[model samples]
Target: MMQQLFTNAKVFTGTGEDDFVSAFRIRDGVFDWVGDAADIDGQDAVDLGGRTVLPGLIDSHTHPALMAGTAAAAECFPPAVTSVDELVDVMRAHAATVTAEDAWILGRGFDDTKFPERRMPTAADLDRVSTDRPVLVWRCDAHSAVCNSKALEVAGITAATPDPVGARFERHSDGSPNGVLTEIAAVGDVAAFIPAPSRDEQIDALIALGDELASRGIVAVCDLLSSRLADPLTTFRAAAERGLRLRVALYPGWDPEQPLADLDDDDREGRIRIAGVKVVLDGAYSNRTAWVHEPYPDSCDHGLRLVADEDVRAAADWARRNGVQLAVHAMGDQALDRVVELFADEEPWLTGIPSVRIEHATIVSDEYVRRLRDARMSFGIATHTVFFFAEYDGYEKALRAEQVPDAYPIARLYAGVEALALSSDRPATAWSGADDVMLSVEAAVRRRTYNGIDFGPAAAITAAQALMLYTGRARMLSPLENVGEITAGFDASFAVLERDVFTVPAEEISEVRVAETWIRGERVFAR
Candidate 1:
């Protein structure tokens, strides 16, 4: 059961340009053959001198155990702290190596709209980095957080507590408490008083973030939240008993004390499975709090709806009565018009489930893309055009210039969705190198933003439709069968590339690179 082949590469069989293959064959892990290498006759080949292969990229939304607890936090972002006095001197040099004098320094991406003090960093600016230890930071869209008066007095969050139903806090004018916590029920009530990493440090941060997402050629994901770990199915069965070869699916986050019949005796084969249920529903248009139908142009308000329409119709009636797939996290346009009117006549993909997705459908419109294409809904759109090149200047300062031509439109969702998927909601969009996938396929084929600014260039798209939203339309929203696509019976899983990101130069498609990655057929990663 072990044959190989590969030869003079090029491959890319996400079918286009006459099914581009230069040779292929794997055997043990699938994909058994695919054309020309002078009609193959050799055995165990492996030449690849031309390099290019493809399809072993699939992110479709991520959060590898919340970016592996941000490798012990403290990063504050943007050319490293663009103000508030370099974010209180990098949180007072990460609280002088935290030898626990009242622990909890944390910290994440930052970006108060590219700071320079454009605001947001209160709690009296993290009490100049230590009101006797307990800082926090977060906002590179982990939907906001600031903390520090010893973390709102150890999360008792005063100023007479209150303010919980769907999050708030940022007070201080006469009303007090200004530690700036905003969405996710006020950043999960100050991250439930911080401190949670054991279970062998969450399986050593999920095998070091699954070998840094298999060295960036990301073999598979869809984690969504995986119950922010504390036994996400025993931390993915101890990350596949420690070999952790990527391929995860997990969705877990609806919890009525872990219901859905406690994942009914789960243990879905090696690389992790529990694929269903994660619900946010609103918040994050670079902190203007995306629940938009219009307001935020410097504010009158029209954001923040952090779930509730009878709790997204009771999490779509428990994912259509426990068949699974729910997803949700809608990004604006009034939370994707109330999740396209609660799955406009639910289909739950004809009962095997995986389809009602919509996470970060960041501002879709044209009458909700014609009400999600006239509700023939089997919905799926896990989007994240690397937040259009990392937050298109905070969506041109909180949208409304005609909602900046429908924010992350991706060529009007590949001319109207049929299961789109692409992702990197990484450390909620700032674990640097803009969560690569060729920098979200060069911001979905150059709709540009890291300062060159051309945001919705008529919603540009086409580096083969942005690498089929991260390969073969991101395995049609993940129950991960034949794997993204290198063709012949699929799943030999690949990546190779060191150029030919579709004949280059769409601003050098994030400089291409990723020289080797394979998965089901082995070679985990190479450089």
Candidate 2:
């Protein structure tokens, strides 16, 4: 007999096509049965008083440990800047305060695209701020970084150094490395010289971030990378051992074609799990780096591929044979085209066969949509522009101008494919909550926002369909069992919705709230 019997709860089982808006029974950490209220055992009832019950939501992407690091730096946030002069003034004030010999003049929240003229902060621009100290002013995208001449000299980068394959080093016409370093590889090159937080410091940050996410009703997260840190394996493990209550799925790092023989298996007793290898096929399109079928209309850039496909195939085949899951990061249509071709024609893999999730199917086109349906590949999307672009514009403009309709294509997904997986690529601006999620859903379904602004509203999906994406869709994307859904033998994880997400007004959906969350049939979060 189960210890908890939630009665009178409206269980949203399955998704749009197979949804059952009915009651369910939970016993011994698994769903015993589901039916009308009359079918439930009254003897051990814990009535929910007609609240909505949904499968515990899953975030298919995030960098959990890096978030922990950000949480650690919250108090040190460099304040906002009003004008160019004001920005310099603020940095000068902060730099003067640090007495340490090698102290960093760190500041976030400068968007090159936002200024009256979309110009990057030059080394000269930062030198005015603090000539005496090393200044590293990062762009909001985190892709582009502007460092003062002092910091640039310390990095040992100059005109002769060729750009890292997948990254861009903004250069002087004289071919010298400009202060701006774009993308992960270049950022890594410069950051590689910076000292990382020690084990104890990282552990402390992880615990703090875990508390933050838990407070936001996030029970599980899938991290992309740990940020400025190459050793991601130790990051998650430290969280588990040091009082992290949230479940973590780490999906990062890949040496293309490298065998996962040294891979770690899931540690269920602990909350953290190594989801699998992450492969970056192409850079994102905004940087004009997403691998594509045709060259950009106005740019000579045909996009860039990080690793050759045959090489990736060898790795995928090896992982499939060995029981490792390969999470490929593909953002451009052309890159996706190549990946689909490879997946369709590749030989059956061997072992670590987990779900082949396509990270950031950002430009999910019609041809790609059909291919996605045909291959039944697991996919995850982060429609975070709603929050990410609160201050900055041009995201939608760039997409529309380029004739890309699927900036957020949930409807096309449900219509053309079977599964819908969602993620909040955190540290993108904000973290989780019903408000943050509902806004994305509205963008997915209503195709519009508060002011009735429309980007690609035609691509919007239904609420029922969207709910499934956040719930059981993760399992569909992976070979994992009983993880996404609540079934007879599945892990018992659920969230109680205070209001029906399907019926709520688009903008008001966030107004509805999370009442409680259960992980393994035990109450872990109560709102």
Query: What are the lDDT figures for the candidates, one per model?
Result: 0.76, 0.61
State the displacement of the C-alpha of residue 364, model 2, in Å, after optimal TM-score superposition.
2.7
For candidate 1, write residues 304-400 as lDDT tens digits: 7866677667766776665567888878887887777777766554433245888888777677777777785677788877775766667778877
* lDDT assessment of candidate 1: 0.76
lDDT of 2 by residue, 93-206 (tens): 767676667666766545444445556677788898677767776554444567888777888888888898778788889988768877767776775665555777777777
TM-score of each: 0.35, 0.83
lDDT of 2: 0.61
